[model samples]
Target: MNAVSAEPASAAASDLPAVHVVAAALVDADGRVLLAQRPDGKHLAGYWEFPGGKVEPGETPLQALRREIHEEIGVRVASAEPLIRIPWRYAAKRIVLDVYRVRAFDGVPHSCEGQPLKWVPASALDPSEMPEADHPVIHALVLPRHYLITPQPDADEDAFLARLDAALARGVRLVQLRAKASDDAALRRLAPACLSRVRAAGGQLLINSRSDLVDEFDLDGVHVTAAQLAALDARPVGAKRWFAASCHGPADLRRAQALGADFVVLGSVAQTASHPQQIPLGWSEFAALCDEAAVPVYALGGLVRDDLDAALAAGAQGIAGISAFW
Candidate 1:
């Protein structure tokens, strides 16, 4: 499905009364997640969604999640981890969908509310069949928490391929090959080798160059640079391919959303050797900016695996980096 622009949680949405809701990506041991079809007469009836309900007064989001799960699906949540927080606006109401990944739950999940329940692999969850607010959740479920941006390739092609293989072996499921100095000829030669290795590892590779190369190289997608984001009048790639962008502020984000970018890499969240002169956004500022984003965002700059929890807490899809990843 093509990426759809998200309704930014801006001041206009704030004017509406906010409804706090909790939902779960109830995962089974086989990695399939549970989906509930909205019953007739409900607001979004006939669409499938992550099962959840409104949070009552004084209840923590987790509390509401467990309570709602039991009431709606006849299962007791033994443990749940924060997944994604989505701020969405409808015609008359605004809602914050506090979602969780529930892998440990008691009892089998059956429809307690007479709604139909289905278990499907995360990759099979269709965004069109779900609410717009749940779109990011699907991305979160399908994407890796860590995004790897390759450093410049060495003069020796085999050395570069070996390093790429090593990173893939380390469990990096998503990668961006960003060799700015390489010419098209060099990239054309290197991309296929990278793509073959990444695919063999069951991962996807995105090129940080012209979108056309994605089709030509048979790669997974294109990563739009901030400058490329500004120059674009429309989405550079097709809906079937991943389209990601790099953004530093609100304007770039708006452009990305308008261009239907699947996800975005934002910040200099922390000082890094690559861009030491630039100031870091810190976690607070990063969170503030994330509130304005409609799609999944990966925290960039000077981040490692240890920073994943902080990134997620700040509403990021995960963290991206060059050195730490390579």
Candidate 2:
């Protein structure tokens, strides 16, 4: 309901009624997230959304969230952190939804405002049941921020495992094993050691361009190349692996969405040593592409930990990189 409020004070601020809303993803120990139905007679009535409300004149987003959730659902937010901010437009209003992950709370949630509330498993959230502006928020809730695409491992196998360990230690929870130089036989040989390190750290690892190896290795998922993505008519059925795709532009983004990919990697947001000749999509271009994307997009090329906040501000899931992460 608060996706209608937050706007920066600027020359254009007065042009539209800016609704700076703060919302919370109240996650329970079972990994379930809470959703509340807007009471009748309100704007977008009967819509299901994260519990939050309009930010008052002086309250910060965090303050607004705690107050709103307390008032709306009768729970005191104990701990929280920023998640995603979505700028959305309605007919006569514009809203900036400042979403936060409610990691812990003090009391049981009840519909203090007489709204229906439900706790849904994170994996089971259906975007179709949510308001249009909320689809991206669902993606942010489910996917991790940093997506690691491995550089080709050095000939030293032990050294490679160490590198993977370091990346995981640095909090890279999502990984793609994109060893372009290694053939299937070599990748198969490396997989066991690589998987062992990632799995031990509780990170998800997906084989790049090799969906066929998924069951053989009992891996978490697959990342389809653009060529592979173009050839597919539908998401591979019955295998039950998470799927992501490498996407360059709007068309690729559309295809990835149509095929139901969990996410897509987009960019060369800045020039990289790996592709010295390819022009990069400056942040402006990157933001434009991301604005149209239905699925979450991870900005790739020449990005590092420092780029995370800027990437999120530009509407990215996070940054993906070879050298920066390695």
Candidate 3:
């Protein structure tokens, strides 16, 4: 998967009029999103974009989405939610796109104009073909907001399963089953029940640092450590699942992005008991690294649900935690 590179900063970054726009990822039941190609004579002609148009004055972002989606695609957006707000600058103009996930709508999408349109699978999407402003939108569409890393698995199966159940009930949609003390056979024994519980809750489970286990048990994904991430030149070729990495700095983040990872976790943002000896990346440092990231980053270590606002403000997608999340 060739990732899209961020556009170079233009003179217009500081001087151009910032246009407000609303866009939609019209996702179908097949996990495919609708994309539109710019027609001739328009700015960025031949470039592909999510279907939407400029937001008019006195209209909320949702209102703009409803109106633009209906006009551009001929489908009435019945329900949509905020996905991401990107402040980007093209060579000629600056635009702030408030992108949404169109969860429910009325009418089949037909090209109201002569623009070409296609429904693309999320994984099959080529971000390089999209406008630079939409690079973050692609990340938002593929990655979830919250990431939960499990604590040390107890020897007692019932206690461990109970804890896992509680976390899922509390809305931990994406989880990493990190069982450091367990070996291949032991972890394999735990996998079936864990997989069942996660699937039942409509959640995705990624095994930590164990690509072999992911294949063996048919888990949803694999979360590689920073060291493991650096060692990889290409993405895993076997069963397709959500791939992520633990990144500590720009190099790790870049490598993960280049490897076509779905997302990355960057931290010890606030320090943690797990790595008390390591210096935490303070909010300022976290923000700086996150700004350079191409994928949606989750701030890990010393973060709780309460820190969600701070994390988002610092440019992180959300918070990831072990102790706090459980």
Candidate 4:
């Protein structure tokens, strides 16, 4: 996520030889992404993955990406952006996979190397069929760039709903309803209204530390607090539902990954009214944590829409905030 040098310390630490690879998620106008199957004799034969190959000596990642796309699929990358970086280890190899979203390209994609290729809907791309390293890439491809954490509902519920509707209309696609001050009955009443509005706006709603209500309200997912993350041994939600966690440090992140969390929100990256006394991680520390993270992360606390670029550059999926979002 930091776009650090291709040969970083993490790669050197591994016993296996370091291999740097660049891949492209070629997106079409209809939002489908191109995937190529590994040929019969290659490693992980028949497994599907984003089209790419090893980065040769002296080639920048962008250069390797352009070269790989043309050789594998017969297209020249016209425009692209970084998506995610994965540090992965197989039984006998180590790899640092640098992936990008190919937004614009010159020609239709075909299997130039005689490997099978298909353009599948982003949501339909199954991680189970891909190499383990590409799983996070699928998450990056399908998930939105901005996540909104809802503020506490006020005494006037109508005003809260109106404010939520406006945020949804403004393209806030992923939301977490964090009404911790409300009682169970009040939350039960509010959940449906929030879900209806979120769905109507083509977004997903996750409940804050409330896995039990997810099924009853037909919500999208649950976001667990750090305490809850520590208490759980197994993932609380089904595969179709998202399971996210709030993590403050390395231990929390390790625990969340052990529990197979879909993603995690890591921060207080900046000071905020919600927790003014607490110190922030700042961009440097945040990027350091992200370097070791296997799952997508969101930078929370005091982040505005303008911080999205900074957050992404720091290896985060996006920025999530209560005040700026709501």
Task: Score candidate 4 by lDDT.
Answer: 0.87
Find the 10 residues in a row with the least total lDDT in model 3.
1-10
What TM-score do all the candidates reach, one by one? 0.93, 0.73, 0.71, 0.93
Question: What are the clashing pairs of model 4?
Answer: none
lDDT of all predictions, in order shown?
Answer: 0.86, 0.82, 0.81, 0.87
Candidate closer to the true structure by TM-score (higher is better), 3 or 4: 4
Model 1 residue 87 distance off true place after TM-score fit, in angstroms: 1.3
Judged by whole-model lDDT over C-alpha atoms, candidate 3 comes out at 0.81
Residue runs of model 4 more than 4 Å from their true location after superposition:
1-13
lDDT for residue 306 in candidate 3, whole number 0-100: 91
lDDT of 4 by residue, 1-326 (tens): 11122222344357767688889999999999999988776767878889888899999999999998998899999999988877765544567888899989998888888989988999999877887678788888888888888888977888999999999888999999999899988898899999999999999999999899988889999999999999998999888899999999999998987798888999989998878899999999999998778788999888889999999999898988887778
Put down candidate 2 lDDT per residue, 243-303, tens digits, no spaces.
Answer: 8899888888879877878778998899888789999998999988876665678898888
Candidate 4 local lDDT, residue 112? 87
- The candidate scoring highest on lDDT is 4
Off by over 4 Å in 1: 1-14
Clashing pairs in 3: none
Model 4 TM-score, 2 decimals: 0.93
Steric collisions counted per model: 0, 6, 0, 0
Q: How do the residues 1-326 of candidate 1 rate in per-residue lDDT, one tens digit apiece?
A: 11123445556666987788889999999999999988777767778888888989999999999889999999999998887777666555677778899999999999987999999999888988887778778888888888999988868989988888889988998999998898778888999989989999999999996688899888899998999999999888887788999999889988997788889999989988867899999999999988878688999988888999999899888999877778
